[model samples]
Each structure stands twice: as structure tokens, then as C-alpha cells.
Target: MFSGNGHGKLVGSTQVDELGVLESPVVLTATLSVFRAADALLSWLMERRPDGVSFNPLVGETNDGHLSDIRRRPITEDHVLAAVAQASDGPPAEGCVGAGAGTTALGFKAGIGTSSRTVRTAGRTGTVGALVQSNFGGVLTVLGVPMPADELVPAADRTEPPGNSCMIVVATDLPVDARQLGRLARRAVFAMARVGASFSSTSGDYAIAFTTSDQPPIPDGEIDPVFAAVLDAVEEALLNSLFTAVTTTGVGGRTSHAVPHRAVIERLTAAGRLPAPPLIPESPSETRLRTTPARDEPGS
Candidate 1:
């Protein structure tokens, strides 16, 4: 786990830092509901554990008070358990879901975003995946190009305070130990700056990386590709969070608007950063002819 700023509560981080292992599924929730969520996670884990054993429930959080009734502590044991039970493999739903439902970032409605990249090193192929709950403040930048001032949200609409927090979770299929994972986590946190994270004093910026591979840890010399993958995947994930979120009306009628996609595309295209759209097939027959696979002759 790498923490760029420690302004928010993150339960079980000290243990993960010391022992370099996460023994439970991570539970993410609002700031005030963190303890309750942790307790629920612990209860759910205990039901299946052997007697006389200790466990640590890994729960992380970001404040969502601006958009939700956070002080009410809406998260409950059932909510945590349902999340654990419904977890499955494959692409996860992103943007305005789960822990990110009430979050915002870079003056736009932000939420859960995820992305993955493939890496090859030491004659072995691996994958790196990142999922981020983006809720921070900064000027939005894309592909090193800043969005135009006129494209930004009007000043009157920017009601949310300057800083909140972002929680990044990185997973990999590579053979790496906790030490290496920590390095990967650091790269994830660093990638935040690529998309214009302020890293403010009041913001909690953290990344927790873990590997699922059972093989022995790879040598540090072969870790460079994995590090590069982390940067690319995380940067894209942050952008995805903003791109996929929809405008949301929150507590006291406060609103966070979604980033303007069409205008952004136009800006990037004008800046020569985005390519023009490819020409479409003229008709269905032409499209079929182009897409159809070739068949083998009778005897070849």
C-alpha cells in the first residue's frame, strides 16, 4: 500500500504495511461508515473461519458527505455482505457504483473506474488491473492537454470544497511479493498526477496493490514492464471515472455535472491528440463482406 497523503481513515493499513498481506476482501464506504462497514466485514469473515484465529478486515474509505447524507452512516452489515456475496470474475461495472456512487473529482461527477493492461517480462505474460474511487480536486487534463477554460464547469456550479480523497486498488496476475506490490502501488498513486491530481493537504490519496499469482516472486530486475503497465492502466482508469459518470444532484440540491464528452473529443481532435473517426461501411452487404472470415477450399 502506498499513501501519498494520509488525510482519511483507512482501517487495517498498518497491518498490511507490516505483514505485507491482506487477509480479507477490501470494503470501501463513506468516511463516517468505515467502522461499521469494517465490523460487518469482520462478522461475515468470522462465520467461515476456524475457531481461535484472528482476522483483519481490510476496509478503506473516502468522504462522500457533499453528495450524500454521510453523517447518517448509511452503510450497513447487509450491504457489505451483499457486496461480498455478489462478487464475481470478469469486467466489473464502473462509474457511479458502489463506494463511488456519491463521489466527484476534478470538478465533475466521478465514481468507480477500472482499467487493465497486459505485460510481458522474463518470457512470461501477466496482467495489471486498477480500480479507483476518484474524489479529489484538480484541473482536468487529458493526454497532457488541459481542457479549455471555456469548457470547464461555470464557477457558480462548483460548490464542492477543494479537496476530498481517492482510493486506488491495483491487482495483478504477476508473481510479486508484498514489497514489489508496494512499489506497484506507488506507481498507481503517482499516475494520479498525470490526470491532474492536486495531492492536497486535506486529500487522502492511497493505492493498495496485490498479486494473485502463486508462483515465486519475480526478480526486481524484471519488474520494469509491470511498473510501466501500472502507470498506463491507472491513468486511463482515472479518466474513465470521469468520462463514465453522469451528472448527479446531491445533498441540499448541490449538483456535480458530468464532464462534457463531445466538447472534450472536439478539443482533443483540434489539438491533434485524438484521431478522426474511421469511415463506416457503406452498406450491410459491404460490412458483411469485410467482416466475414475466409473459408478453406474443398481440399486445400
Candidate 2:
């Protein structure tokens, strides 16, 4: 019997989808929340106005087993709101957080990973955001890099992980409709492929997208500025998810290495895809820096 949900921070009897609606803008929760979290988020779309409202909510998920107790149903209203409320406009940090708590990829630690690319069109520029629940299996190869047989875990290994599931949520302030957004979602599958995921047979690779473009409801129309924005943002957000997610380790004693952030930055710089990190300044002759509350040193 499921337990934690509301009366006790999480009423166990209440499924994640039972959250109803939010009184604020944007909300997030992982799987099992196909209803409550999504509905509440859409409900929040009308927070400012008492008038009726409708919005297709954005939600993403990755299976969490290696690091979290999947059977507990620990996710709660507080957790969903926290994810959305804490979301920053800039690049999102990745790996083992948010929707990735109990996920795995190719038998390794995989949860949510994001990546983004900058695109310049016409004269206007905008940022696209991507959130992912990374749980799939293919192989581990980055930018045509080879995975040595030594590091290769045979797909049939007893310890090998199951083909997992993932959900990608793309958001843009761009002007676009549901159809365009759907196309953008499909493209995201390719982006994942580039990072070593082959869309396993037992895995589910679904994606959804939304836009914040402000426009009058149209029964039908021609060119769409918002639609264009969605494509641009979606492309970038996927990249960002891949970019910011560090490797992680979750449940079952399996360790999922976060793509080391510093190492990735260095690799990007080598590929000329990124500029070098700025240098740190040395202290002046008259100035001295010290580590506060020095850590304990044995036999100091």
C-alpha cells in the first residue's frame, strides 16, 4: 500500500498527480505525477487572474533506483514546487538532482543531463532551457570518441542495468505552437543519440516542449515568431542539460560518474567549442589569503 502524500508533508494515499494546482508560475515533479503536479501547474497558470485558464504543463522524469528508494514514493508537493521555484534562468546544473534522482543509463549512473547551443537569427536572440530525466542505454562515446573494450561492460553482464526511461522538457520564451514544439521534441532524441544513447528497445524516450511567447489565441495563422523561438531554445536547452549535468551515483551501490565539469570545460576548450576559463589573480605582496576554519590535519 502506498503511504506518504499530504497530511504528513506527503499524503501516501495521494499519488503525485493529485497535487491539484499551483498558485504560482511553473512547477516540476518527476514521474508518477502525470496528473496532480501537471494539473496544479496548469492551474497556477491562472494565479494572477481569477478567470478560467488552460496550459499544457511541462514535466520530466528519469527512474531513480541506484540512489533513491523508488518504492517509497517520497516525492511531495514541496519537492515539486522546489524544483520549479529554484530553477534559475541560466544553465541548469545536472546529474542526480531534480528528475534524475534514481536513474541510470547504459547501466551507469544516469539521471537528468542538459545542454545548450547559442544561435543567432535575424537580429533578436533568446535563451532556451532544457530539463531531462536521463535513463537510457546505448554506449559511452562523446564527440566520436571511442569507448575502449577495456571499459566496456558487456550488455549481457549480470550487473548490467536495465533499459531505462527518460522524459525531456523543453521551454522557451520563443513564439511557437504545439506542432512546432512537437517537432523540436523529436529532434531532442538525436541530441541524446550523439551522447551515446541508442534509444534502447526497453526504454521510453518521450519529449515535450512549451513556449512563453505572448500572442493572441489564433484559430489559424501563417508565419509564427514564437514557433521559431521554440526551435532555437529547444536545441539549446538540450545542449545545456548535457552541459551542466555532472556525473552522479544513485541506489544499489552503483556509481554513476558525473561528467566531470572541469574536465568537460577543458575538452570543449580543446575542441575550440568554448573559450578558456579566466585565470585567477595572485595575491599582492602585501596581501595574504587564508583558509578560514582550517580543516583538521592529522599529526599536524
RMSD of each: 11.5, 10.8
lDDT tens digits, residue span 1-300, model 2: 111111111212122234322234433344454355665555455554567654445443444444554444555555555556676667565644555555556444444556444434334454556666666666545554533212533332234345656566666655555555555556555556655666656566665555576643222343244344444443344334443444443344444443334444455577766678795222121221111112342100
Candidate 1, residues 1-300, lDDT tens digits: the string is 999999998999999999998889988888988999999989987897868378889999888777877766767788889889999997988877788888889888888999999999977898999999999988889988886323555642667877999999999999999999999999999999999888999999989999999899889999999999999999999999888777776666776777777667666787899886463222111111011112331100
lDDT of each: 0.83, 0.47
Quote model 1's TM-score: 0.90
> Which regions of candidate 1 deviate over 4 angstroms?
148-150, 278-300
- The segments of candidate 2 whose C-alpha lies over 4 angstroms from its true place after superposition are 1-58, 148-160, 215-252, 258-300
Q: How many clashes in candidate 1?
A: 0
Instruction: Give Cα distance to truth, residue 189, candidate 1, Å.
Output: 0.2
Error of 2 at 229 (Å): 10
Local error of candidate 2 at 72, Å? Answer: 0.5
